[model samples]
Target: MLYKTKGIALSYIRYRESSIIVRVYTEAFGLQSYIVNGVRSAKNKTNRIALFQPLTLLDMVVYHRDDRDLHRLSEVKTPYPFQHIPFEVAKSSLALFVTELLSRTLKEEVGNPHLFRFLLTSIVYLEEATEQYENFHLAFLLQLASYLGFGPENAQEFEDQLRERSLPFLADDAMTDALNTFMSQPIGTPVRLTRAQRADLLDALVAYYRIHFDNLGDVKSLAVLREVLG
Candidate 1:
């Protein structure tokens, strides 16, 4: 059946001679995979493949099937085209990290409108933000955990939960303060932290996520994100 939805492009892999299979997180259907054909053909001039860029916000009409694991896209376009994420190094690196994180964590094949709205809002905010976005990914990770049902309310809870599982994590005063800020404040709020501090906090956050999700292996974009943010 055909459905209209807003989707966030997560990732894609080349399928055949001229097609690709893209994974998208949609507002109406949670997460889905669609096989798009002819996007890479030499005769194609419209560059339709650009719609699959990581974290791109798309408006789509799709053919969904309850019994099938893969589906098809009848139409797709970027309604809120990013203005800075693709052009700036720091923002682009953050986008990459966010995409990888979402692809790993979001696995449900059901509608999650609230989670989808949060993701959409965060993506647009990151794109338009020119400064004070260094903490964006950290904030994003913490908030996303809440939607996944494993979020801690504060630094103490974070440490306590890890300790309960025999996972050693010691958050110093600075890291504690940063965690509290990220957990309590909005994404646009600024929290001052040096490059090294931010990197350490990110490692801690990833460890926290690992406790809840067994397969969230090494974030491939972490090194690049750290270098770009530095």
Candidate 2:
């Protein structure tokens, strides 16, 4: 049966000569993989391939079956075309990191309305914010950890979790203050940190995530994001 759902495009890989298998996190059905044909072919002139870009917010009509692992998209269109992410290098880099993180962590095939709304609002927030977004990904990771059931409540708790897991955390004043701000404040809130401190906080967060997700290796986009943001 077909259903209309809002989805966030997570990632995709080439399937055949002209097809791709794309994973989308749908509001109605959770994470799903869809095989889309002909989007990569030269004869396909509709440019539909752009619809599968990372973190694209899409409104879709899809064919869903409870027993199927891979489903099909009947129709899809961007609900909110990004105004700045595609144009700004830092934002684009952050989007890639966010995409990679989500693709790894969001694996369940069950709908989570609260988590979905968190992700949707966060994405829109990143896209709309014009300044002080370099810390966006850091704040996002902390927020996402809460939704994932392992988040720290404050800077002290963050350090405690690291100690509890035997994970290394830099005990720097700047890093602690910045993390406290990130944990206590909402996304887009202004916070100050040096380049080195920001990098340290990111490493600490990734270490925290690794404690929970055993197989989450080094984030592939981390180097690029660091370079672009710095």
Candidates in order, TM-scores: namely 0.96, 0.95
Models, CA RMSD each:
1.3, 1.3
Which lDDT tens digits does candidate 2 get at residues 167-203? 8786677777788777778888888877877887888
The residue-level lDDT of candidate 2 at 30 comes to 94
Query: 110-228, model 1: which lDDT tens digit per residue?
Result: 99999999999999999999889989999999999998899998899988988888877777888899889888888978788888888777877888899988999889998898887
lDDT of each: 0.91, 0.89
Backbone clash pairs for candidate 1 read none
lDDT of 1: 0.91
Which pairs clash in the backbone of model 2? none
- Tell me how many residue pairs clash in candidate 1: 0
